[model samples]
Target: NLGDALAAETGFKIEMIPLPMKRMGPELISGNISFICYTLEAWLPSVKEQVLWSDVIFNNQNLLVSLGAKPITSLKDLDKKRVGVVVNFYYPNLEDSFNKYQIFRENGPNNESNLQKLLHGRVDYVVLSSLEYQYQKKLQPRLNAYDLGIDTFGVKCAVSKKSPLSVSKINQAIAAMKKSGKLDRIFRLP
Candidate 1:
């Protein structure tokens, strides 16, 4: 979707190279990748020397979700329970908050394996995006889901410093797309 949007806006033949999110920072720094779509917190520190944030594409709220015979309503309820999370800047904050609730358990990086751990009772709950939860539920109907209200954060496209000109054009195109409601339309497309 992003490749199509970038191509249509910039008139450039954009080719997307899919890589695991964990490897994106190093790739960007080494000039192996031009840009990356990721959370602001994760991209900020890694790109301090050679990259700058271009524009925000979406805002996502992370949820602490649980599945099983019991329902979770508050952070305190997660005490001594295993929680799954993606490795990112937000993990520290999550860890601090969980510590306050006396919730200490295994923490694993986000991946299919970690998700499987949660699904199979290896972890007590998983912290992830609400969209991810909904999508996963469709794949596994027996699992219960709960939303633990949390901070909302922005998702953005980061550009390497070597491509300042490209960033300018991309930002301009993004602004136009927003003004024309093209971005909203594209995102809502089924």
Candidate 2:
């Protein structure tokens, strides 16, 4: 939907590709993809060195969720607890505490799997993106969640260093969308 909005606003044709997170960087560097969207700069240090990043398109909220019956209100509560985390993803401010407190991390292939672990009582809590958590709750209303508000970070699109598209152009369209409230409307943001 953002791509569609950007194209409409800028009069530029956009091609959207949905690829596994790990493959996005390789494909971008190889010139197989023009740009990859919805990525965090923190998660792509190497990719940042290789590509041009547009201004933030949106913010991704990183949350620590647990069943409402046993809400995890603070990071200190996770001491020696099992945390379900997505494979290859980084926690913004919790890694050091994990080691110092003996917090056990259970790797899940994706958000859904981590969510499942929490639902089944396999893990004390799971870290998930707020967007993913909302979508899952829509599918299964039984899951109760409490927000940890661990961190919030900007999400940007990465373009090939040699691509014809200018980061400024993309940023312009994104700015227009934000100004017109098109992004908030499309994403149902507050």
Candidate 3:
């Protein structure tokens, strides 16, 4: 994992704290935690404004999922279609277009459920991370996907505004790992 690689590369002990999504920002901003990684700036705008971010750790592409028989390649393809989305996930540039086309937005607990919605024909399409779609597709082997090219977002590691760790130091460590290809190896990056 990138976290483990970062710790080893930096010669620092890193602890993983699993917290509720809403709690992560408040905790980080208050310095209750040292740093948090694998987040999108759009997912936590207020936290982004108050924290230090490392270079992109990875990119998450938001994809459109529909039945293979009826694939959707773009937002315009979603006009008047029922679309499933997980609660609390933001669809950046596509939302306004989805709205303008009067796309029906259905909410699900998570990606799997939205995927199930697509499989069962309960929704016309589902918006999900490409990573998740690929993982699920391998299991089901019947899921369909089309790249929503404009919806790619960067995932970053971030430190608190007043943490003991220096942002530059963390960035340097990440850069070193990148240079040595440790990050690509750990993440199986292409």
lDDT of 3 by residue, 13-70 (tens): 8898887567778898999988887777787776778888888876778877777756
What tens digits encode model 1's per-residue C-alpha lDDT throughout 1-190? Answer: 7668877888867668877656767777776777765547553575555676768776666676666548878777777787776545455446686657576545565645567887788888777666566667678776666656666667677776655347778778778877888876765422
* Candidate achieving higher TM-score, 1 or 3: 3
Give all candidates' CA lDDT scores.
Answer: 0.67, 0.78, 0.78
Off by over 4 Å in 3: 98-101
lDDT of 3 at 48: 75
Please give the range of 10 consecutive residues that has the lowest summed lDDT in model 1: 86-95
The lDDT of model 1 is 0.67
Candidate 2: stretches off by over 4 Å: 99-101, 142-149
* C-alpha TM-scores of all predictions: 0.78, 0.85, 0.84
What's the distance in Å from true for residue 186, model 2?
2.1
Number of the top TM-score candidate: 2
Q: How high a TM-score does candidate 2 get?
A: 0.85
Q: lDDT (0-100) at residue 101 of candidate 3? A: 64
lDDT of 3: 0.78
